[model samples]
Target chain A: MATHEEITGSLQAFGEGYQKNKKLKIMNKDWDRVILIKAADVDSQHTLILKNGELTVTEGTPAGDPDLVVTADSETLADLFYGDITPTEPYMNGTLVIKGSEDDIVRLDFISLMIWGE
Target chain B: MKRVVSVSLGSSGRDHKVQVELLGEQFEIERLGMDGDFDRALAKLQELDGQVDAIGLGGIDVYVYAGNKKYAFKDGLKLMETVKKTPVVDGSGLKNTLERETVNYLLRETNYLNKDTRVLMVSAVDRFGMAQAFTTAGCDVTFGDLIFAAGIPYPIKTLEELEEMAGKLLPEMTKLPFHMLYPTGKKQESRDEEKAKKYAQYYRDADVIAGDFHFIKRYLPDNLNGQIIITNTTTAADVEFLRQSGASRLVTTTPVFEGRSFGTNVMEGVLVALLGKPWEEVTPEDYMDLIERLEFKPRIIDMAS
Candidate 1:
């Protein structure tokens, strides 16, 4: 059993790797409205929003109008970047869901393949 | 006892293409160059009325290369209309084509190849037909990097260069333009079986191995005992190596010829080999009976000619 901090660190490393590779640059350059939704927080608790590369929470705040929302478990999210599960298949199978930006979904799918080596 | 018919559609020269196989022995293949209006293509097929058991077409690569999606749906609809009774298999439906229903149809009706006999397929589109052939023949396939994403091993610019690479790398290969590997090593002993072992996991179960020329080279087991089919490729040497490598047969189409897909060639070639007839001489009658026996009646005519 790995610690949550360890898993988050791994995901952050992968995110940095993807950034270094320019595989998954967030389109439209608006990081303030981007949110990562964990599966455990389906009720909208623990929403991690990135603003100027800083993290904050809109916990219990009326589910704000974010530009993009990525929803998946931490493990699945980690594996998404690692290329183990196909994003398209997962999306189709309901393992992952993205809202607020179809373009972001496309970009995510393309970048996921580049980052994950699929 | 269903029959099998395979068809392909894509641009004549580009790499993107599709192949579809239907269960039965007979086939009705209607091919048109990527040129001409869809109406004209429909006219050509109308002439073959009641003659085809299945229909395949080509040209997606040209569209992708040119970034034009025009006429694609029209072409598909036109072909669909022509082969009203035939099952009109095309490359896009690979997943649906390879179901248990289809495989059982292929095995029960045909006196299929059993790995020892060499069968050749030309211009197989993508990896679908090759996968089906793998299930039918029970032998391993190898190829070069053009099919896989891994990159070409040898530097080749011309067909002759490819052939040279094939001879120098794989002397025992009997199939050319295989989607497997272009040998960088001469002796099978020098060839890296570990690499083969590592890559085999990706396609150990796949009937067809898809990769660039190098991907084929990477995945091929050192001990191969069957036939090979070459799809879209440019290297002549790879073809030469395949011929040397105990490949029981080799199938190829004219270079850059798209409308008349290599997949159709693969299907017709295998069927000819199975029926023991010269490939060119094999006729629609041979396939028609298979379709009739299989009961894979074509869809009712959706539109008038």
Candidate 2:
């Protein structure tokens, strides 16, 4: 029910909130990873970049090898931002799937938990 | 309009209504919290049994699931047998389905707590769904159910310790009345400052504190400057309380309405009423479908406290 731009904008806003947070937790400064979220329904892409302990959301690839790639429908991605559905069920059922190394998958998922706090 | 009511023995003497409109059909959700008075709450349930469209059993869960196992409470079963009316669900069924989704949502969507996160779970036995999710996420989870819930000190180091304690505690927990577990009000906590002060260290030591709001609130330090709290069932005043205590970020597992996040039983009642299906006939898939369509996402409040 949401557009790719809307999802991108929402993540950006969430990143801004994290930055403003004085006592919030962030991925350690030493760790940085670029994640590509592919919305197969709309055939659009948004990148979530975490570098130097700060997070940013931008449209399309940001000139870096993404450590993780998540593919799912637009509604599923929208619901993820809205804090409802988890990628596990979709990933398990093959409605939504992810491509990444074991460490990236685990670490990125942990980061996702931190961002949304579901 | 469909009418749904919740009966609870551990409501701590609170009662109210929550309204949710699904597909343009209005639903009235009423919660009757009898504090420690189970008899009164049971009486209320009997009065509304067949009259109401659905009934929600609050406070104590009917079944607690852990890994591939489930343990049902004897007292909860008795209440169900007596009701014998319209669909009566404890919300545990939906909780089992939704809480896992919630954990996975956090795991794959947000960057909240990591494996190194020190989580102090007040009563993992009561909400096994959360317990399993936290452990699966690889957090350094500590179970404080014995100390926090039962007012007995039992330091839990591993998930094994938690399982052992849950096996023993969950049974006896439902037998006793609510007052034995929790004091009546915040002021009552002053009666045991020594105990409260001791718990402040646990609150201070943990990076990411996770548990029920009541348990966390019972032991919160005067300040929580950089703490991230993961809990449910909170009121607006509780939010102010956390803000005053310096909670850096707060997220309730359930949606906050009016000034509080409601009990799962209330949410389940809403779902049952909306589905308009017999409780026994509904499945996890049905709940998931209704949840996604409803998009009843948990609330994330912006705190200034």
TM-score of chain B of each: 0.28, 0.87
Expressed as tens digits, the lDDT of each residue in B1-305 for candidate 2 is: 88888787654545678777777888887777666565776687888888988888876657765446566766567666668767888888777667767767777777776887787777676667777888889988877775675544445757775665455344344443344454433322243455567677777777777766666776776777577787776767677777778887777776666676877877788888888888888998998998898876655555663
**Model 1 docking category:** incorrect
Per-candidate iRMSD: 15.5, 15.6
Q: Residue-wise lDDT of candidate 2 within A3-91, one digit each (tens)?
A: 87777765665667567643233323545778888888786798888777777788887597888888888887877765465444465
Model 1 residue runs over 4 Å out of place are A1-7, A22-35, A41-64, A81-84, A100-103, B1-52, B57-305
Question: Could you tell me which 10 consecutive residues in candidate 1 chain B have the lowest summed lDDT?
Answer: B61-70
TM-score of each: 0.30, 0.65
Clashes of each: 57, 19
Best candidate per DockQ, number?
1
> Model 2 residue A60 lDDT?
86
